[model samples]
Target: ASFSHSQYEATISWPQIVAALANNLYLGPQLGIDEDSGYPIFNADPGRLFTPLTRAEYDSIAQRTVYHPQSQSDTLAFTFSNLDLFQLPAGAAGFAGVVEYGYQSYDLKPDPLATQYYYYSWKDSDGSGSRNRWAAAGELRMPLLDSLSLSVAGRYDDYRFAGNSADKFTYSAGIEWRPLESLLVRSSYGTAFRAPDLHYVYSGVGNDETGGTDYYRCRTEEPDEDLTDCSYSDEGLIRTRSGNRALGPETSTSWTAGFVFSPRENFDVSIDYFNIDMRNQVQDLSTDRLLQLEANCRIGSDVNGNPVDVSSPSCIDAIARINRLANGNLYGITVNPVNVARERTSGVDLSAHYRLATGIGDFRFSGNYTWTREHLFQQYTGDADVDEFQVNSGFDIPRNKASASVSWEKNAWTVTLHGDRLGRLPNSDSYDQIVDTEAGEEAWIGATYRYNLSTEYRFNERMRLSFAVTNLFDKMPPKDPSYPSSPYYDGSWFDSMGRSYYVQLTTRFGGGPL
Candidate 1:
């Protein structure tokens, strides 16, 4: 048995410029006359802009003071194991078990000065928030036959926040079989759950960027315009989003089956298939979905022939729009996270390795590839699922990826060459429409490939030096005009930093007991 305890704390302070940017201090009210009406525009209505302030007035309201935010966490854990309690007469024990328990508490406190300057809905009485969670887990493994094995595991977790508590359980089972001397097969099925993180569950108030069109504004431009057709005229919106305490854990079930083949020495290969179906996937409704729901409520019926009540809590919560301009131009909309979506993804993975001995050195080669067959998502329980395979809808998940490496070692020197590839991705229908309207044609991104080389030499038994050149060709990412902010390419899927070189040295001197 073993036990442990730990405590941690951290503090963060922001500069004057950071605070000014966060608060949008550079944007003042408009003071000019309207061109269409030839009328003086002033801060006279809720949606009207305020008069532009002088430099002195702007400085007085900017609040250039520093902000010091702090957070702390405490953790305690206990573990027990009895894998050696039983032994077989042949000296080959085939049974094992283990158990563990842990608890953690977290607290966050914001700077008083920051609270006065920022616009947030936090109302903690003492300017602090806290939450605690505890979990217990156990696992067992046993051999069912001379060439077969089985394993099972389970875990339970309880979380407490402000006087409320919630509990969840997850479990999994797996099996392995060696039917032949050179072949092995394995399969596993598991269920998992994830509680909302502190920021997702207790973040008082914050702002986020959302992509969608303003229905009211769009209708004014074209009387018979459809909501789906309005995306061409929309860029995006900034809005408020808050955490929800009533959220529960997101759950998922996954299964995998694979086989390994080793036909000869120094050579092997493996292939695996995986599938995951998740329910109650925690996510905030996108601006487009929110607007669609609001439109459904206004029509008194949903697409599935279900009745809709405009005054219901769900409807009211889903619709939040602001018109900052007196002429009724939408500035933004609000959204919050909820456990309301479903996602299903399936894929296959392949890997292989081979080794050979040469006159000068020993060479080894390995490669791996993954092909995603399907990636589907449903916004709500009763909504239809949308396929996102091979499309880049801002999720950053590509349909195909592959990598290969070759290495050679001789005496005290080792060298290796590696290559990586990312398959092409298609744009979503709405995004495609927006691009076609702006550029007069359809757009698509092509595949990308990168290479790297590394070398290492050992000076002695205790000293070593290594060097590496990443992105050997200094290849640049492909351009996509659809994304204005990052028109170069998808930074998440491709390297935007270009080529980079690195060198490392290591030395070890300690050999005696401490």
Candidate 2:
């Protein structure tokens, strides 16, 4: 049996810039217009037409710019294992069981100024909520034959939160066969359930400033401009988010089959294929996707000016989430978490390892590769499936990813080298529409690879020193101006840091002495 507790707290603050205050209803009139341009002129100088805030007032409001949010969790679990039910020629049948209980809670408290929108910050919602969960599981392994084994497990989970409750049962079964001393085969099928996370289910309404091209706004304001080559920059757009208490658990079914081949000692190769289908995936729509949906609903067209179904449920939700100003300008967007129809993916994984010992040192080489066969996603029941590999489909995941490493160990020193690679990806999903435009040059960012090197020295049984360098060759992410976002690269897939180095010394001492 075990018990554990965890807690997290954060105090966040945002700058109350003069420009933001100038846009406030109470101050916009006081700050007069520019005499020459006839537009609102922002000036800090007191004698100018614009009236600026006093230093004292600025200081007073700065003190009220902080908000605090905190979360805590307590968990307890009990388990019983190593109970042999019977004996077989190969081994004894083993069984195990476990039970777990947990409680989690969170509180989001915004500052008075923020709650009242006294500054640039939006009026954030405030609330506190909690949940309780219980789980039980059992597993059994049986060696029915000398060359084969089978195992099965089952689990049940129940969750209660915010006047709502959900329960799920999951199960898995597997089999393994060793037909020859050098080869082994295995296969498994399983089902899983994931309850809504504490923060995802209980977080209060909040707003953030994000950037995305408002397609509807762009087309409405610039009817004569060519949108294909348009680099319409839209920044500091508001995105509001809030949690949902009625969310159900996400569930998945998965299966895998694999085999391991070991013709000799210290060397092995393994290959596996796996597929998973999930339902009721809980997630929040990204800013770009949300805006695109809104445009499709309002303008009845896609980015390429193609007609789309505007009467669908997805379109209805999209239109409702977007708020507009008096002049039909975009005011903000709401992106609450909701359950999507389904997501499915299948892939194959290959791994190989070899070890060699020589008079001077021991060397180990290993490599792994993954090939994604398919990835399908549907946001709603009638929505079309989105293929991840298709260009301009909004999912830019490459089909292949791989890593390889080599390590050598000598008397007291160990050195290692490793490399990671990702297959080519289309520069942007909107590349086709802009192919004839000026921003379109490279259609794809070729396969990218990065390397790392590390060395370690052991001074004694208890002391060691190590040094490492990442991106050993100082590789840079390929430039793609056609991509919509700034920095011209996928920040999610690449790091802007050119090269990094680190060194460390570690020592271990007994409780009695150093």
Candidate 3:
């Protein structure tokens, strides 16, 4: 039996904001007029305007600035194993089994003064805010035959928050067969579950200033007007995202089968086919969907203009009146995260590795490639499934990706070269409203390739040095006009930081605490 415990804490600071406010530099309200061109400030561009604020105005804003925020987490675990207690028949008597239990707690504490700044979206707590969860797992391995082995595992988790609890059970099984001295085949099937993260489950209420057409107002303006162009303007909509205590866990099932071949002593290759089907996927009710629902309700029709019941669960859930103007106009709508979607994806992964020795050095090469055949999603159980394969739609998952690396080592010196490729992704179809709005175009995202190089040297056994250059050729990411505010590139899958170099040194010493 074994046991362990750990604790961690971090402090976050916004030095730039503090410095700007202290120096009375362009951190306050915009000027009423341009000082240089003598023009009325229709839209004061902060980048071009360096106007300073009055002493009182600067102090007022500075008082609300948050200099520091803190986050902390704690974990404890215990494990037991009895595999060495028994022996099996044949040469495969190395059976093993293990069981473990663990608990973790996370807390986020923001400065009280920061909560006064509405623009910061700063979260506030009356006390020590924390989230906790517990997990237990067990695994067993056994050799069923001279050339065959089997394993099974299971896990259970419980998320506890205040007076609410969410739990789930997941399991998996696997088998391996060695039909030949140089070949091996393996397969596994598994089930998994995920609870929504704290940010999605426990965010504070805040207004998000955004630009989009309001479908409800548009429908009422011109009965036959195109929904896309009506009331299309930047609006400060009151948005609230809070923890859903009743939220359930997202569940999924996955299976994979593959074979490994080593026809040569120093060369090997493997290929695997994998498929994953997920249900009860946790996601926020998109604002676009909410607007669409409101439009349908006003028109007494569905997305297809078919007459439908307005009081249905889908419609009622989307139609929320969170805020209203003094004139009794609807001011804001509520959108919350819920378990409502399903996803299914299938793909194949191929990899190869080879090693050889020469007089000057030893060389090693490795490569891996993945091809996504299908990526389908259904918003709700009653909705039709849409294939997003090869399309940068909802999640922007690419259809294909690959990487290769070569390394040479001689004496105490080593060098390596690596390359990565991301296949081109097609824009979502016009019918896919979510993607159309987010990406802004129905064109393909150009393919991108990047390279990296690194070198390492060792001085004796206790010290070593390394240097690396990422994006060695300074390759830029493909342009996406839709993301002009975000450096014109998708940071999720592409490198936004151009060429960069890094150097590091490592040392180890054998001694007592000193």
Candidate 3 structure quality by residue, lDDT tens digits, 403-511: 9999999999999999999987643222223344456445567678899999999887878899999999998878774442435566567666779999999887864
* TM-score of candidate 1 versus the correct structure, residues matched by position: 0.69
Residues 1-514 of candidate 1: C-alpha lDDT, one tens digit per residue: 5566666666654433334332334343447789999975544353323556677755554434333344555556666666654554423333333344445454455555443434322212112346777778877776667788778888887777656676788899999899997899999999998877666677666554445555444544663654346543465666666777787778899999999999998999999999999988888656655654565555666543457677765566655443245755556676677886789999999999999999999999999999999988865655545566423232435689999999999999999999999886643333323333467234456677899999999998888899999999999877775554434466556657778999999888876321
Show pairs that collide, candidate 3. 201-243
* Candidate 1: stretches off by over 4 Å: 1-131, 208-232, 288-328, 358-362, 390-396, 407-419, 428-443, 449-478, 484-514
Clashing pairs in 1: none
Task: Compute each candidate's TM-score over C-alphas.
Answer: 0.69, 0.79, 0.73
Q: Which prediction has the highest TM-score against the true structure?
A: 2
lDDT of 3 at 34: 75
Root-mean-square deviation (CA) per prediction: 7.2, 5.7, 7.0
lDDT of 2 by residue, 45-140 (tens): 444435575787565445446778888999999999985788977789999999999999888766765655555545566667889999999999
Candidate with maximal lDDT? 2
Error of 1 at 191 (Å): 1.4
Off-target runs (Cα >4 Å) in candidate 3 are 1-11, 15-64, 78-90, 93-103, 111-114, 117-128, 131-134, 213-238, 284-315, 321-333, 390-395, 426-442, 452-477, 483-487, 491-514
Task: Write down the lDDT of every candidate, Cα atoms only.
Answer: 0.67, 0.80, 0.67
